[model samples]
Target chain A: EPEVTQTPSHQVTQMGQEVILRCVPISNHLYFYWYRQILGQKVEFLVSFYNNEISEKSEIFDDQFSVERPDGSNFTLKIRSTKLEDSAMYFCASRGGRYNEQFFGPGTRLTVL
Target chain B: TQLLEQSPQFLSIQEGENLTVYCNSSSVFSSLQWYRQEPGEGPVLLVTVVTGGEVKKLKRLTFQFGDARKDSSLHITAAQPGDTGLYLCAEARRGGATNKLIFGTGTLLAVQP
Candidate 1:
């Protein structure tokens, strides 16, 4: 089965540095999203992108965060200035067809020190 | 913002035992989806419940959407050790032509052999 895939499975970065997480959603899927889960906490929505623009974003998706569909096949999330609280597992998801379920990537674990 | 609360943050059960996990929300959702996530991985979609009073089953797992569309449940019959994972429920929050998921608190289950 086709699955969402993310690169750099684990990343360790210092605070105030920039980090970019990459994801390749399933081919032919349109809607895309970025979410984060602090260890042992709920998965929190950061932003959603469609039609080359942001569709929805939560408070967590502040100026420090940005998402881009850099190309037809790659979606990227960039953290301009990482903070200690930014340490978390970031997941990328895509939905297609009826939009009943959103497929997720393996996730990029970001650890900020 | 919609918040989904899950019961029994952690559960450890013996193999072949049956258990139910829950997802509740104060706001209504057009659809609720259940996902299973293993350590170091993103969540995998398990089921989606769209209509009120809807029930859907997949193999040993059964899912139900409450009549009010504000809650859902997952019941596993004779669960095996392979059923161990963190379970999360989510729904797309309506926004300007975009759909983004808001997830539940999550339930971690460990089925012991």
Candidate 2:
């Protein structure tokens, strides 16, 4: 089955540096989302994108976070400045339509030093 | 914000045992989904329940949505060591342009041989 794919399975970056996590959602899926899981914590929603714009975002998705569909296949989350608290497993998901199943990617582990 | 609470954060059982994990919330959802995540991997969707009091079964696992649409449960029968993983319950919020999911804290199950 086709699945969402993410690049840079793991990344280590210095605090205050910028990092972009990339994802390629299922080709036919329209709705895309980003979520994060702190070590031993619940997975938290970050943002959702559809129709080439952000549809929803959580408080955690503050000024530092931005998402884009720079190309037909790539969806990326950019953090302007990384922080220790930003270290987590970031996941990308997509769904084709309302009430359709959302598929998830393997996730990218971000570590801030 | 909608919050989902899962019970018994950790469970360890012998092989062939049965267990149930729950997801509860005060807010109603249009749909609820269950996912399983192994170490170092992202969550994989197990099932999605859309209607109130709906039930669906997959192999040895059964899922039930609450009558009020605010809760759900996952029951695993004759669980094996392969069932060891983090189980998450996520709710699809109602009346939104985007189908963003609110995830529960998750239950870590360890099935030992």
Candidate 3:
């Protein structure tokens, strides 16, 4: 079965540095999303992207966060500055359309020190 | 803000045992989905329930959506070691042009042989 794929399974960055998490959703998917989970916490929604624009975002997705579909196959999440609290497992997901179930990637573990 | 609460956060059971996990929310969802995540991996979609009072069975696992569309349940029968993982319930919010999932805290199940 085709699945969502993410790059840089794990990343370690300085507190003030920027980090870009990349994902390649299923080829035919039209909607993409980014979610994060603090260690031992519930997974939290960050943002949803469709048609090269953001459709929805949570409070956690503040000014520091941005998502881009720079190419037909690549979707990326950029964090302007990392903080200790920003360390978490970030997952990328996609769905074919409005009524389809979202498929998730293996996730990228971001560690800020 | 919509929140999904999962009951019995952690469960440890012997092989061949039966168990059920519950997901409750104050807000109604257009659809509810169940996912399983193993350590160091992203969540894998198990099932999606779109209609109120719908039931879907996947081999030994059975999923049910409440009649009110605000709650759901996952029941596993004769669970084996393979069932050991974190189970999450996610709801797709209503009234959005782009669908995004709000995940529950998750139920961690450890099935030992």
Candidate 4:
């Protein structure tokens, strides 16, 4: 079965540096999303994109965060400035036009120093 | 903001045992999904329940959506050690409503042999 895939399975960055996490959602899926989970915490919504626009975003998705679909298959999340507290696992997901099953990628582990 | 609460934050059981994990919320959702996440991996979709009071089965695993669409349950019968993982419940994002899902804190199940 087709699945979502992400690049840079793990990343380590210093505080105040910028980081970009990349994802390639299921090629046929139309909707895309980004979520994060802190160690021992619940997964929190970050943002969603559809029809070449942002459909929704949570409060946690502040100015420091931005998402882009630069190409047909590439979905990316960029953090302008990193902090120690930003360490977490970031996940990317997508849903196709039918059945509405949301598929998830393996995830990118972000570690801020 | 929509919040999903999962019960029994952690569970440990012997192989061939049975267990149930729950997801509850005050807000109604268009659909609810169950996912399993293993260490170092992102959440993988197990099932999706859209209608109130709907039930679906996947081999030894069963899922039920509450009548109010505000809660869901996952039951595993004769669970084996391979069933061990973090189970998460998430509400589907409605169109124009933050395309992101609201996920529960999660239930970590450890099935030992």
lDDT of each: 0.91, 0.91, 0.92, 0.89
Least well predicted 10-residue stretch by lDDT in candidate 1 chain A = A93-102
Model 2 per-residue lDDT tens digits across residues A1-113: 88999989999999999999999999999899999999988887899999999999988999999999999999999999999999999999998645687889999999999
Q: Report how far residue A81 has shifted in candidate 3, in Å.
A: 1.8
**CA error at residue B39 for candidate 1, angstroms:** 1.3
The DockQ of each candidate is 0.85, 0.75, 0.75, 0.69
Candidate 2: Cα lDDT at A82: 99
- Give me candidate 3's TM-score against the actual structure: 0.95
User: Which scores higher on TM-score, 1 or 4?
Assistant: 1
List runs of model 2 lying over 4 Å from the truth: none
Comparing candidate 3 with candidate 4, which one achieves the higher TM-score?
Answer: 3
Which docking category, incorrect, acceptable, medium or high, applies to candidate 2? Answer: medium
lDDT for A2 (candidate 4):
91
lDDT of 1: 0.91
What digit string (tens of lDDT, one per residue) describes model 3 on residues A14-57? Answer: 99999999999999989899999889888888999888999999
Cα RMSD for candidate 1?
1.3
Instruction: Report the lDDT of model 3 for residue B87.
Output: 98
* DockQ of candidate 4 against the true complex: 0.69
TM-scores of the candidates in the order shown: 0.95, 0.95, 0.95, 0.94
Query: Cα deviation of A64 in candidate 2 (Å)?
Result: 1.5
Candidate number that wins on TM-score, 1 or 2 = 1
Ranking by lDDT: 3, 2, 1, 4
Candidate 4 TM-score, C-alpha based: 0.94
